[model samples]
Target chain A: MGLIDNINKLFDHRIRLGIMSILMVNDDVDFNRLKELLDVTDGNLASHTKTLENAEYIKVEKAFIGKKPNTKYFITPLGKQAFKKHIDALEDLIRNPK
Target chain B: MGLIDNINKLFDHRIRLGIMSILMVNDDVDFNRLKELLDVTDGNLASHTKTLENAEYIKVEKAFIGKKPNTKYFITPLGKQAFKKHIDALEDLIRNPK
Candidate 1:
């Protein structure tokens, strides 16, 4: 496939891209932290996270920290593989441009 | 601005991204060639190229070669600088992840 074909559309959005980029290196990230990191509103973060979760790119776990709700997200194995492919395609486009 | 903020929304589309990538390397490219390179339909290519042109990221020159009308695209200085900044932000996001 061409480099353009390999560039995943899901990661095209800045919010989604930011979410995956954060998840790629970190073990797991919580809701509030992701919001703060991406500098996005709660609703914006929630919606994008839901899309990633639906794609199975990221998995969410809900827990309680002293009775307070905490939602944490982790990148799945598939997510990591797919994101790596996308980044590789971008790098290839920059280096080769064909 | 944050890395996410630095990522240009105009380049979020694969077609537009492809167009800029090609223009960044080539001195100039014609309409049909861009269509072939991007593997997009004429309308698709036209629309994306128009978007770039509207942004002043690219300029369209009209002329005739042997009575055949030709439209060529060249990246503007502003476009080059903006694209470079966007790429740099992506690289920073990959390297620093913050």
Candidate 2:
């Protein structure tokens, strides 16, 4: 939604894209780690994650490093494909801006 | 959610991304045109449009060609900037698909 207004439900908003960017880099990242990397608020991050989860772009893994309960996130196979396609579509837009 | 599962609050969803894509091409595609181009339902298009409108990415112009009611949409200046940035980010991802 930030700058990509005309674009479809693919890659437009800021926060949702940010989450995907980080996950694209790391094999699997946790909630706290994502929060730290992106510097997003708790509630904001939660809702955004919920949206992605509903879309099934990312899979949540509830576990713990030691004692503390933690939620880890990783891009699903499907998510990876989406990320690639989104990038392709974005590249097309840039190559041919209107 | 189809393929882009891991990305962030940015350009991750399918429907939203689709809408942006069509708008990116045509200057001012109408509701029916968009719905037809994107093959989306009325409520779905409405909700997505609301989100983009709320994001201030697209401006709606309501007028009549000749008594028949009408509405139109165009990308905002800010939305243009965001689209460019988003494309750059997406390019980065595609170049290095992790």
Q: Number of the top candidate by lDDT?
A: 1
**In terms of TM-score, how similar is model 1 to the real structure?**
0.95
Name every residue pair that clashes in candidate 1.
none
lDDT digits (tens) for residues B8-74 of candidate 1: 8998888898899999999999998888877888998999999999999999999999999999999
Model 1 lDDT at residue B64: 99
Ten contiguous residues with the weakest lDDT in model 2 chain A: A1-10
In terms of lDDT, the poorest run of 10 residues in model 1 chain A is A1-10
Candidate 2 regions exceeding 4 Å error are: A1-16, A42-73, A76-78, A85-98, B1-17, B50-56, B63-67, B89-98
Q: What does the lDDT read for residue A4 in candidate 2?
A: 34
Ten residues in a row with the worst lDDT in model 1 chain B?
Answer: B1-10
DockQ winner among the candidates?
1
lDDT per residue for candidate 1 within A47-84, as digits (tens), equals 99999999999999999999999999999999999999
Q: What interface root-mean-square deviation (Å) does model 2 yield?
A: 10.3
TM-score of chain A of each: 0.96, 0.85
CA error at residue A3 for candidate 2, angstroms: 19
Model 2 residue A35 CA deviation in Å: 1.8
